[model samples]
Target: MIIDLTTRKVKRVVKLPKTPFGITFDGESLICCCSGKDIQMISCTDFSCTNIPKTLMSQYSYIAIQGDKIVCTVPDDSKVSCLDNGKLVWEFKNESVLKKPGGITIDDKGNVFVVGMDSKNSLMISPDGKQYKQIQTKEYGLTEPSTIYFDKIRKQLLITNINSFAHLYDVSFY
Candidate 1:
């Protein structure tokens, strides 16, 4: 459903193919990760849908886009994958660090932030998918964090748990 922010009213509803799990705009089209390994690109103007070839067996639960790079988290498989122009670039999987990875967001520099529902933590992964550092943990009152967003303009990170708690943090990358 599309809403007009100024009037705060429903504008138009565009029907999707399958149940949309994760969605992001790539400056041109709305890239949607649907259930059952279906990734589609819906036109912003006409709302025409085009299917993006799937490369993984696992379903995507969360997604973020930066330029031609698309990142998604597969909670069922406990993995995160990056695709460039619909081609698999890198896949990160470290159950010890991120178990059941759920929500995902990408920074201007392409750094990926993800939350683990099972691990009850959040971490930042390098653009190359090599290194990762824990940014939030259970000690920070994160209980089953499932969603995350990075505000590029404000340089803040927002994380929300499955329950009722939400956290905002000032993030700086040096």
Candidate 2:
């Protein structure tokens, strides 16, 4: 998405990070990784934004929010966790399982969806931090997934493969 600074309209947008960035939409706010450990949220009301800290500034790579909680992904550490207000609510670590964890998203029911670069299976987690399902998209050619989003308006899950094309999945549950 291009950010219009009123005086000019920027194009070919980027997140000012050496590595790729992660993003998520929580209906009311647009959340993005700050290249640091925390994520930044742009308020839908006035376009104002503030950072959500997660211990330090380089502990995370991406973030997603469920309700008022902010859930972020840490690749090198192979984990994901959430911060409530300003305190850590929960943390999960599995180096053998979540290698290079990348994109993340949250459903209306607070189910978390995440994709990893070297993961044999994408993951789903309950709001309480219980991993529920593992969805394999290898058959669909998703070898190195980068981004995932639950599009409310289209009732579908949009996924982007690194340096590749994007695919849409029907997730209407209808």
Candidate 3:
């Protein structure tokens, strides 16, 4: 559902074939990670939806936009992938370590950050998708972390988890 923040009213409601988990805006469209092996692209202007196929993933959890590319987390497969208008570009497979790849956010520099639902750790991949790094660990005290977002205003990385409080990581470190 789309809402008008200033008016505090619902502006539009979109129907989908399956549950929409992760959502991101690519300037002109609302990209929804659909439950059943698909991503829905909805045009902001007309609210028209187009479903794109995801043959590699059984389920989708989170998604992020890095410029014109779409980075999505496939929890069931414990993998992350980059797509160009629905075409595969590059992918990272981590089924051995990452159980359920969950929340994902991309920094302005295009670094991709993703969390694991059961692993209690976050992974960071280079903007070009060549370098992979494990970021958050138990020492950071994250418990079942869920989502992450880069606060452009404050220039920090905001993380939320099962815990009541949210954690803000200084962006400078990365």
Candidate 4:
């Protein structure tokens, strides 16, 4: 079962905090992060919204569900955080790599994958964010990746290179 938000019937649209870089469901509502800063939690039943944790997170480009944890990509730095109870329990940092990373996804096994602009490869973080792998394909990237997702059943990772292209690749391991 797949629900395409772009073509599907409008469930609802609650206003966001800023540019709304990424979104993920939080049982009762959808938590949308706007421009790496504010988080707006919108009700699934009516799309009503409220702020979660009562504090803005660090600047991030994307967020997604990695098991029960939330994987968030922090900006201006090559680091991603797996958060719990408003604290980062796991972190992945690369000082001399990754540039302008924008999108992220997680597999059913809880492996984390992230993409950045102008690169053919994306970073894959383990469930604990302690280990990482690089996911790449010849046709998929080496460009700008604005959006990305993992297809659980097929074990395929999809990359939406927003510069007028999209691609799919088999991601055997994260």
Measured over all alpha carbons after superposition, the RMSD of each candidate to the real structure, in angstroms, is 1.6, 4.1, 2.0, 3.7
Task: Flag the better candidate by TM-score, 2 or 3.
Answer: 3
lDDT of 4: 0.69
- The candidate that achieves the highest TM-score relative to the unseen native structure: 1
- lDDT string for model 2 (1-174, tens) is 446678576633434333426666778777777555456666766666676655443434777776788777878777877778758777777665566777778777777777777773467767777565666466777867877787656767877888777777877443
Task: Score candidate 4 by TM-score against the native.
Answer: 0.80
**Collision pairs in model 1:** none
lDDT of 4 at 87: 64
Q: Which candidate is the best by lDDT?
A: 1
lDDT of 1 by residue, 40-157 (tens): 7888788778787764325648889998888999889899999987798999999998999988999888899999999999989999998899999999999879899999899999
How many times do residue backbones clash in model 4? 4
Q: How far does residue 168 in candidate 4 sit from its true spot (Å)?
A: 0.4
TM-scores across all candidates?
Answer: 0.93, 0.75, 0.90, 0.80
lDDT of 1: 0.86
Error at 114, model 4, angstroms? 0.3
Q: Model 3: clashing residue pairs?
A: none
Question: Which pairs, if any, clash in model 4?
Answer: 36-60, 118-143, 119-142, 120-142
lDDT of 2 at 94: 69
Clashes of each: 0, 1, 0, 4
As a TM-score, model 1 comes out at 0.93
Q: Predicted candidate 4: what Cα RMSD to the true structure? A: 3.7
